[model samples]
Target chain A: MSPTSSLQPLERVRVAVDCMGGDHGPSVTLPACRAFLASHPNAEVLLVGTEESLRPAAGWSRCTLVPASEVIEMDDAVEVALRRKRDSSMRVAIAQLKADDEGHAAADVSVSAGNTGALMAVARYVLKTFAGIDRPAIAALLPNARGGFTKVLDLGANVDCTAEHLLQFAVMGSALVSALDGKDEPSVGLLNIGEEAIKGSETIKRAGELLRAAAAAGQLNFHGNVEGNDIFKGTTDLVVCDGFVGNVALKTSEGLAGMLTQMIKQEFSRTPMSKLAALVALPVLNRFKARVDHRRYSGGALLGLRGLVFKAHGSSDAFAFERALERAYDAARNRLLDRVHDRIRDTPAVLPTAPDEPAAAHAA
Target chain B: MSPTSSLQPLERVRVAVDCMGGDHGPSVTLPACRAFLASHPNAEVLLVGTEESLRPAAGWSRCTLVPASEVIEMDDAVEVALRRKRDSSMRVAIAQLKADDEGHAAADVSVSAGNTGALMAVARYVLKTFAGIDRPAIAALLPNARGGFTKVLDLGANVDCTAEHLLQFAVMGSALVSALDGKDEPSVGLLNIGEEAIKGSETIKRAGELLRAAAAAGQLNFHGNVEGNDIFKGTTDLVVCDGFVGNVALKTSEGLAGMLTQMIKQEFSRTPMSKLAALVALPVLNRFKARVDHRRYSGGALLGLRGLVFKAHGSSDAFAFERALERAYDAARNRLLDRVHDRIRDTPAVLPTAPDEPAAAHAA
Candidate 1:
């Protein structure tokens, strides 16, 4: 067979996924897998997890199982992820991806809807990173006013990150945009307290400088520092930050969305006349719903990994899981990891200026 | 004259509002102000801007016009805040608040739906902070799960803060929560990256330590550290955060709420059948409409100030402005500032830990 790295057409790519992950786990993941398989006849999934769990997901002919002896409970601590990847579903999923060289299936991507920290640790240790990437950021697409979604990285990876790590996120995020949005070089923004470069923590200020220099050198669409309020405003296509802030921003957005939707449910229950008005406005409502539901885009792509590794939401349903597998297949077809590695390798390394000397020396 | 601070059940609390501060400034603010006065029988409003601008919404009284020489454009930088305070409607509104205090008319609150940074700077500098408090925080009351709201403070007061500042926010948030919810010494949460003591930035850690000692001493109802996700979960009654992160959290929450609500509206309208379900559930929909309409909670009490300072939404309708004034009256009557002072004063000064003895000595 041609080398597995050949720009494999969607039909040639195989995606390995954790059959049991997330709240809806098998119920959601299996159906989604079948749905994805139904559309892409050649795209197959090596469903990794307990065989007993797989038996219930019945109707798939193209996909097979890679049984995992153990399962990691959603509530299991992060420590378990590193120590027990030998048996856990997430670990088995990665092991299947790493087993690509043997050509058993040439698994191009690994997908799991598991505990986030555990996934990050596994992806980091198992897949490793691109040459310049010290940390692989968890990139997710957010809905914007422009009818397009933006990618944000470090969504909840490392709580405390260095400016250098943010720089790496920008590089990887830039590549992901190329792979996903077809943008030659998507604009990169450093999520900050304010738009002004001078305003933010020391790390942000440092990252701003690196991004600015990179922008000047024609690397990213470097849109100076962006405030948290600007994320939904769609000021830029890509936002980068340390996981601490990114996690907070993401979760805060989710919380607010949950709160608003709940409140909307209550408001619709109010008076009869208002309900009538809502009926008339249902079309407009659905447009808004699809724009914000995020179910289709729930799986976050782990950038800078050796291969495509998509983390579906732990609370994901089958639709969410299927969407993730599709994303993984796309990433594999696009050779996202190789592209990131190449782009990063080709770019002139950002050299240290006097002020950035210490940061340059700092390990991300 | 009796203190205006006492809500002795006056004819209606008169509120002076700067109508030219927000993006939609006059159009939205004008109508909102009119709507507010109409709903609340005892509400009176002084619309400050140019006479020409106020005419459209001033068909009836409860509202009068206060002409200003120039309007403070929203795009003007911070420098414009101080320089144009003499000519701007926002400054004019603050001046009205002070003038009313002297005249014993004491407009219950001066509401502004304008430049937040300018509003906060002008209000605090002109109004000054309350006794024993160094700064005021724009406290946001978010809709929580228990059919109630939780308060988060220092939304954008200061970018750089200290442990003392957080301590003060906890004290003030407590007072405001008690005022709004009748909850005594409400549970207070320090907004950190994680619930664990080991989590957060150095400053947050320091603040957490201070809060721990204070809580142990029975000063505030400190519930250790609360992650950003916990904010929407409504695990605590009060959340204390520095201005930078707090501002981001509050604005992000608001933006997310608006985005999601818009999405839900669109999703319910995707097809003819869904539209019919919406039509059938018209009354249910109307009930929901009343629930998430942000106009109802369009104002926030500016905590830690000597006098009640209220912030109406930038797009506040007359109804929202009226509610803001109402919130101001409630805050003042509840002795928000005085209660904060009392609690803070009663708590003995917390000394730095032995680990920071050298730094403390150096500062002293």
Candidate 2:
């Protein structure tokens, strides 16, 4: 759990930004990038998009315009992102993380607010997966009732995950939390219907066994099983599940929050008395909203990849996108990629393929 | 769909109550039953519990005390409820729905606030599944943004579901909604990660195909694939999914709601000024709270069983338990059983084994 690099002025953390992704494209990304640069003195940004599209950030300090010919729409299929849009801003942004002939990478990390499927496909194809990892997973922080964020992974990345995959996710998630949150050891909970070992599908039961074995071997801080409610209760530092379930939980939370917010607004505007009350309660309500705002937790790091890649919400505003940028910068500064490798290297018994698998072949 | 029985002076809807079930047991059940009886003059209640516990409701009008020797605790295992506690109140309540030698059921419906696993196991064993239904599903109403309840099924009934099981859930969910909500044809949506047909697991894709086939054959009002958020958005009248996913989604929604409620309270009570604002906003806040209260939406109907069985939350108060009883009563009065049978009988093409499978064999 040592820092990979000292916070020296000479060591600049470069983040490649996909300027033409998300709903607002440059409008959100540019402003967020500007704010991000203003805060970090020793940080650089590789603006990856069409030359004309990135014209606004052309003369910005410590910013490099990495030209990309095409744009990947939020609705584009995986095939379109992987094959047809080879020069997509997302692909070029990810490509900046690839090492050069002299073994120096153009960017330390990449961030995109693009379609999840497209980003995953493009990133996996360009930079490739890390050694011992069969598939890369989407990892994000969910705000919990404990007033802290619980890291959840495999969120819509690999829908049909195996028991071994769950164990891998646990290892990857632990590293991400340790590197970013600075928690040396984080407890991981296997998400299931019931806390009992016998509950859930065959895959889940098998996953529990693997996680327990990993825990016994001192590889993961496995915390038995947890229900969906446990995610918000902050019962564990990390909650691991298959992509489908994770995706559903994330979207369900969003949906419920949206409904409640609307309901509150509707209730306050129902009568003149209520309107007066709302006016009085305005400051308190705004403070409450800020505390639970999803924008503060906008980044979803793509774990198990050779290079660091992050995803922001497709509908992110400047504030939200800036949070994503800050998250990516923190992950890069904390040496997330090396931390993942260290965890995988140390836990070879849990991940048997690490030693034998060649880097290039594993990436492919 | 035609009514199985017209409202008449002789036609009294009887509901069997598992008085010994739930956290408060008789404390909650008795008051709920009393309120239910007062509301529906023609409705009779079969209070199934030990005679000692039922002594308080002894001479109540239209209330019959059906004595049971044992009680199933909230945390009792399914095996304990099925094998050991044969005469448990939960079992006895479900038994009241079984047809007697004279071909008449003792009760029209049953309600319990016991553990879900034990209740489902006992209900399935005693009442048996309906013909063509391989596994029973738990259907419940969730408050949606459109000011209506979205009927979601398989809320932790059968963990491992096949494509056929999902189709069965859709049919049963459709029946439940049509009967309870009085919708002639309720549109059913298959819960998935995305709205696209090819976005989920293999089983989901197959379920989507089967649903489309059923729709083409004019059996179900299939609304195609829906994301988890769609459930709250009121995209469809019914959202069908496997028990595992449904359970996770249900618990996740509960978790988010609880967190938001707590946050709102904390925010309003932070300071003297905030508390004063809260005093002013008390009426509006209470109104908003009532609208989104989960208690109003209590009761998960165990569908696909031969008899009607509704499950209240184990932690239900008198008001919440009453909601469950009312739901059961409405379901019974609306002829939910007959509706399910009619739907199953009509969609034989979608259910291949319905014509050939015997009731007893399917039950086993």
Candidate 3:
């Protein structure tokens, strides 16, 4: 409970959670909710789903029940998002956010670990689209050698993407880095097969032209085309790709983490002396572990949505769920939804501007 | 050398070398050719390219010059393989392998470190296609957790591959496994995003279906669908994919190796004590370095061609070039090409009954 006392207090941030999502269900969600509430005593939480299913999950005093009679299966089609998962906790959560006649539309945020496809589908359908945004994008943060990773999107939300979609993703991602990483202008790199200005799939090449023009216009800090090999090199603050390759690259990196960790364990076990050395170096090892913990980062915000919606790992463990709660709290406190709104809406079609230009050119 | 003394003095295999191919050209290739000829004293070499270019290079002895007039530039289009570079090093090298009048064609191989697309085009044209093959495929070996690693194919030869093309790759890869790793019947894992029997892009899904039929008919050992995250988990001996994803995976792995090695060096430099530990482990470090050196396995054989076509790395240093030469010499001396031919030609449509009878039937 001292977290409230341990830090500066701010206005309460309401976070609606899909209590019925994830593999462990109420077993993990209930405890995390209690932990989060204990830490941030002023926060409000709406636990969505059937009362029968969420009753046990409502042990925390910080939680309020948002009852519904639907549950969407993981295997359900994306169309179900339009139909409202009849029994899905995710739908009920969104419904509760939508009904905030008390000025909730612009104040609250939603978080889900349910079917990612469904979350995007329903969020776009119910929350409506952000002005000037054509689709919602899933952007992930990776540990970068040069500090923070560049965001790569349409992670897996849309398979068939146009060059315009790539351009939009770059803009949204740049806005994020500026707000979150405190970079007034973050460099953007288009993912391609070559680092040359003249490379990649025909689509990527065309996207390059648009991005370069935008960068020249000062809309983005376009760093030119970067190869898949350059993603972890931290060559840029954002990476643009179609959903298919982006998803594959994301999964491949995740898989490599598991593979490399397993290899390290085996390598350490190869000799008793090395095991002793490893034991002595546990603190340094802990530093490395903390440096790469995905759970600490938790959910990836589904950007370009009118309402704030974050996606936790479908297979996230307890700690991951706790971090998810904090992320929702942070996003709400940050007024991320409104920020996304003004950034997209207020930007001129010309995007960037030359140095010494009037700040009011945004009105043009 | 002693191993050669024990042989029955069988006729040595002859191989044509593309002296002008690769980034280092004469600087790297000339020494590599001499070292290769020295290792296998009885082997005959036909060094293809202009005599003037080869003359000033270091260590040019033990090679029989087969003159080529034109040198194909690295960025040349595949069209050059048909016209302008007809007498280029890459084309002339393959021509030597196809001409029976050249004395070497009866039992010889060809090697290049040229433009991958051009090499494929020229090899296809000069060597022609094998009896049951429609196209030649590029194959590379990746390190796996288990010793001997998996042999991956269609690295980037065909962008849009058919089910039959993938199936044939499985067949050819199987024979290569037998020739290179001595695995009589290697299990083929169809690369996809998930490990379940069902999952992947439309192309992989269809290839999985065809593999199921082929495996059931005892043509190859099919190990079902494999996830990208589990690629190095040793689920199978060979992973088959179309050119696109495979190229991405290959390059991603290479780039990762660079990033990780750099990170480790930085980590070890954190303090004086860690640096001291690093110094003491120099010998062991060398062993570890050798274990993961990509150059040790730089050359990959282009399977299903009428004549041998070994592809070396263009960025290969002197050591890497030597390793490629070694691989080329081993392929020729060990009768690898002849073995591929016999296996593809004679391996029964009904492969010999194996231990895992249920696998093929259960995979698709």
Candidate 4:
């Protein structure tokens, strides 16, 4: 908790929303903003889009409209978003987090539902990165067997990573989990092919050595190497890997879950008896469905930036969009930026200056 | 099917079985062999194990006891299995596939449910790769939404791969799918993070160029690039990737499926009302379960070798082991080895002579 949070109890969390982003645009964002404001008593929203697009949320309680002329389409290339779409709603929304002359950012955090490649490019250009951090990574939560989440980093940001970059990811991920989950020390696991240190590729083996060194210095709570199954088994609170492998694992799980759900529906609607059984088992089935529903976990935090930003799924519905807003608000409310700074400062041995050009240059 | 297969109608498939390889040892393999023989009339079995372990099946019809003095434990290292345990059952069973002095092989194919690392090492050491092939790869089947299986290669055989190696994997996978599915030209997809040709790492981009060139020459039915979800979506007949990414994707899917299955069981047994509902929904649930059952797809073929070797899961039961046996029989019956050799000969441009050194050295 912030030191002034208790002293000034009325301090509301301010979130800047990109209303012209995602598949549904204002159709989803307007409704999500209304519901979010209704639920969070101490909250405010800055709706960022064109004048026409923000008309729906005009004059609403605790809502302000910040007008921008352009919008970044879901299929826009990173170069288009960077060099061409200068006044895009996504860019304007992220700019709201920049510190003003008084050292106060216009909004505490920003949330968007847009193209991931474009979003990362815009966010990095505007906010830059924390000192000693070469590139930012995407970190998200995956539900585990313990009914909690396992934080995974570099989801789809940097395809190729060095051992030092992986060490930076671990530090950033540890701080995110510590801030969001309110855990003082979160155990971090390096994703590998086996539990032994000698497993995985050359990069992974070198990463294991760095993580152990960080653990020995009491800067990180590093567990030993873990396999893919260990992510769901909840062997550690956080799992870190190169973006390429992490992206494959994330998408593979999504594919399997989608297939299983479809098969269940197909099986239950096969015959008259099965239809009758479906009615009798509707409650249990819904409960099971809700437990594994991916919509509840819709936000991916862009960590290692100077300001806080959250990216929701581009195809998110109203309910899922609301979840993303809640996540961004919670992150800002918990002082995640300060926690990340503290973690980087504590792990000075592993954190290094840029070895080469930034990986962000390859986002295009 | 082979031309000789039709003319020599009475030709039976001969399979060498390492009965003491899996967790249950003879307890699982003996019954699986019995069941396999009962279902496959035109089949013969050569049981390889210690004399005491093979005694139980001595009087069984169409069964021969091939005695071995040692057993390779599930935890044994690759060096132990290669240099020390030369007389092990796993080694003897694979040896059955070697051609004899009479220009005829002792067994048509070999099946084992032993440690994957040890199996790959011993098999590669004994069988060696084909003339142009540098390393052997583990190819396994995964159930897809099309109501069929997708053949994935290099599951855990070679961790670090080059562009040429991935191209080799594509040719080998194409042949495996062609033989098993009876498709004249099964589509081959290179696993990547995005569908665009310019996406992914430098190695992937180079591999894409090789695959496209082979496709232009009519050597392969290349489906361009595919993302991870395409594997379960059945976008193509085969998905090729480096062993590191492939292994993580496979194991992650397994972990998610296991978690969801457990959650369903827990929900169904939570209360008396839910338990009654479960009883009514039993038939439908069982149908759904049977569709997604992992046991029916247990065999993993070690492709690119001089001899045929199929690896079953170490923890398989009687039913799963039988599936592995049936797969091996089908492959032998379909002349998978000849198809692989034909594909390699056709795509000579992408299949280069050994690049640097063989990747099999890193398997240990």
Candidate 5:
């Protein structure tokens, strides 16, 4: 029987959520979880946080509360989260996923809106990396011109990565798009300054060679090198880069989008005449805003771990947080972990050997 | 006496224009030059290209045609431009800046909308680097939230940069901003993934430390590490980064802006109701467009060069090319090169030494 065959269509998909992790605490997460349970009749949530904070969700039937005494602050360091806060809502939620019985995890997936460094550290400590994978990458969906989303990683986990690590990211990213988006063979693009072969630094050029070999071996659908603009152009289904570059690109886009929105608002409210004009243009502007709404694309998967985990924006409200829950539910329902395992297992020979020395020291 | 005092306020500012460059060649450049000469009574133009292509402006006084035999194709390799196209318009224009009369440069500045790599290669070989500066950076102006522009570099020049190189870029950028914007001490922010002290790659972290030292020594007005979004937020007057990151950030912003503009248009044209709404909002939309117009910020300076050279967008129209010429004229009029020289000279003790070995191999 298949791994997912044990559950019927009407059977519940269990999700462990850290309700006290984000800036809003239970205020945002509790409502989001309630909405998620209301929509997904076959899904149940294990709310992991202090009993006092989660008191509001006591009346919900499909949602159960699991108390955790400690809280991981938004600015807490990784060492503190990893060693000190063993019972943090973030950690306890991840633990539920790890408490496997007969080779099966308890919760189908776990999610949090905690400090990224702390969350990654706790998740990695609890679930550990999948076999043959050295690092876990943070993958997020970016809106493209085709009215679709492109998957880009590593968003900020592993600040320094090797050529081998980049190759692994490509395989994982490809597997992700294939599983979630239902693409048979997702195209992967290596993020670089220029599309030319002679461009970029030594590490990037070396990564290109490894990616080419994988494509030649039928491991991935490599679309060759792509510039930053390609991320929004939908030139490829997946874009892979080291965390440093990916984080900068992601944050830069956010900054620019925020500025543009603010500028538009300022323009419409500059004068009484413009305010009247804004009323006439309200429908068009609202449509444009809904098209590029950040609430619609709120979840980012923490890939390569043995168990599934999704990260929501720390400042996300009820609507945005609910989208994160939906993303986790979709990934769990689609057997994202199994798909990743199958891809990795099939491409054993194509995987590059990790360097003997640590890659961080050599990263300039 | 000041070098500029010889020429009074109404005296001519000689400009070497590559008439046979960009997509439209003479069709765009000739008209742009004519418009530029008409606006600035103290400006003279030396139209550099084959005489046949530049025949349209033959009868204009104060507009001289300098004949060049060959043309640098938009796709020509740097080697092709440097070796084979010896008498090309791009090279001849740069040569005008190098040809000194009584120890004074012939042209105040040269403007080109040619192949960037080819132009940079030719300019560097002909004019050479400024004293104490290694690689010349490509500096461009990005629109900020304050209705002003932030100067950013290196857009795509040096792909791999050392900590010392970053320090040089900061000094040059600060000088440029101070001269143009008339700020006593223009704030310089080093671009990175996080604002925290312990974030980013080794090169970036080291650059941060050096920048801090420069700040302590009163050599630069350092604003510390800034994230990508800070570029649009107007967090600093100048953002300095390695070419790879800067180029990706810049191109990504352009792609996003273009996509948003296209999406807005698509939304308006989708249905008759939205179309009518768009017509009502046309005034406000046009105002927004004028505020963030790319044509107004077309020129990017090749900083740290012994001589001044500006790169215009290859697809620039006459209006855009005229804006570029205006930018060059402003920099020349404000004595931008002299300001850069003064800052570099004053901060001799604070400058970092170039590493003994090449830094490219360690670039991640």
Candidate 6:
């Protein structure tokens, strides 16, 4: 058994959930919270939302309601959510994860199925970035061929990142997989157009050098540059790229997967002969579906923040939201935030040189 | 029937093949040439390679060998091929597509499965860009849910693209799809992080405005901003983006598809029950494979060049290279190059404003 498994039974993990968020709002989140509480006996939830809508979860012994009058809509602008809705459910939930009385965190972690832009804005404001970290990145788990998952960072957080920002992402991502997956030294692959060292933009090429220096210092297991295919091939445990490239890659894979699934079903049901074949293929197809299910990969942790914050899919159902909560619980129980802090603090600086500066200045 | 079909019966199309390129080199290219010649009775091939490799296809009535001394290795740098290997087979094949006597082109199109960088360098140096076009984009067909293909451009040609470069790609892609797919005004989607105008980088946002203006002027059908998923959903006939984003998206889809296929097979063969199920579901599986076969989508045309150039996958087998050849044949026979030139020339100028200039300067 792991250290986290031992801590899970002895201590209670306080989870602050934004109940008014997501597509179904309270209908989905309340039932998921009920289910989550049942499974995790030592877990408690502070459900933040409108009191009237969150009344369904009021009866749960382990659940408490933190009423907030305002709600951030799905399509609300970041500025509107940040300045206009100060006491919004999403903001209140994130605030619960902030440091409180006796220098202890009010909630171990916070999970929200809300507008990503608004959530990021509020989370950054409530729990500012960790020391030495410039910006927080959105890290998500993607299914790989190894039957395991690869952690990809900066999914859509920082669109235009410098080489130093990429190096920071690598450090944060390394800390993440190490804490959650129990890998002592996780391999980090810098996402590029090709595996060759000479490939990619000036920012990426410089980032590769920093990653190499970090690997040399035993800070990370740098796998050099990897192409997009390497992400699914599980060439490394962690992949790092700018938000623009990473977001495009993630969405493209989702789109292609959906198309292929639709095409497979259409082919199987096209004619009477094929329909008979589909009946026999049902079991195998179900197994395949379970292996690549998007619901299994619902949560994206907003890394580099001083506190643990996870963003569940905005359109998540009860089951999907539950998975996101479980992911957060695991991270909190394992003390992911502390691990990141320690890792970033201990590592020797690998800051990139400015574009106009001499290349010698970048040497650590 | 299309105008190309009418012209096919009266005229014979000459194609130049770089037989020394790709993984299999002469072995794959030779047999694919034989099959191509057999299918297109009104077509001839100029096989460019070493004299030793040319000996195998000497007996074909319509096939003529154009021997070249040097061969560009797959890993060779662009400068090496450009400055050193002047007599390379890939260079010679591209040269055949250039205008020869009486201002008439020597070959309708040229096909090569060599190093992409080297091929692009040689093609640009020999053929040059079309009038008013800055750079050539790599455009390929991707299978979509509509059972047809969507043409995507600038796969990896120009990494850092300006807004004006994106507009050029849009114009070129529109013309290619229009002539080959018979769409009078094919819809072009600007690949972005989100559909909202507020999302994406400054370059992409400006490109969107230019595209909208082009659409209003009746030069192309601009479908505003689309997420990566829209590429496979067939939301538009053509998707345009900078080389970095487009390359990452394309490769990620390929990687995910490959992983899914592997997982499906592994699941089917895992248990005795599943083995029997696999046997019964062979027909449906075959249909699924046929629908999403990567080999069927091998060729990516090097658009905006003065002469027509099509690139085959470096690792293509006989059948895959044949698909590339056939695609080039289709593009050549349909007068794709001429169509692109005409479309770009007739379209009203919607150039992007200079970075330092006011937004009002772009209202053309």
Best candidate, TM-score-wise?
Answer: 2
Number of the top-ranking candidate, with DockQ as the measure: 2
Q: Candidate 5: which stretches are off by over 4 Å?
A: A1-11, A99-101, A352-364, B1-11, B99-101, B350-364
lDDT of 5 by residue, A201-254 (tens): 788898999889978887788999999999999999999998888888888899
lDDT: which candidate is best? 2
Q: Lowest-scoring 10 consecutive residues by lDDT in candidate 1 chain B?
A: B355-364
* Worst ten in a row by lDDT for model 5 chain A: A355-364
The alpha-carbon lDDT assigned to residue B306 of candidate 2 equals 81
Q: Which one wins by TM-score: 2 or 4?
A: 2
Candidates in order have lDDT scores of: 0.71, 0.87, 0.68, 0.86, 0.84, 0.85
Error of 5 at A108 (Å): 1.4
Off by over 4 Å in 2: A1-11, A356-364, B1-10, B353-364
Candidate 4 clash pair list: none
Error of 2 at A277 (Å): 0.6
DockQ of each: 0.33, 0.83, 0.25, 0.76, 0.72, 0.71
Error of 1 at A276 (Å): 9.2
Fraction of true contacts retained by every candidate, in order, equals: 0.44, 0.80, 0.20, 0.73, 0.79, 0.74
lDDT of 4 by residue, B1-364 (tens): 2221222222688899999998889999999999999999989999999999888898999889999999999999999999999999999998887765544677878899999999999988887887678899999899888889988877878887888889899988887886688777889999999999999988999999999999998888899998888889889999999999888888888888889998999999999999999999999999999999999987699998877889999999999999999999888777677667667766767675443222221111
Candidate 5 residue lDDT tens string, B298-332: 76999887677899999999999999999888877
Tell me the lDDT of candidate 5.
0.84
**Candidate 3 global TM-score:** 0.79
lDDT of 1 by residue, A120-216 (tens): 8877787676556667779998876566777888887765688788888887887787777656667777887677776777777888888887777
lDDT of 6 by residue, B68-125 (tens): 9999999899999999999999999998876754456667789999999999889999
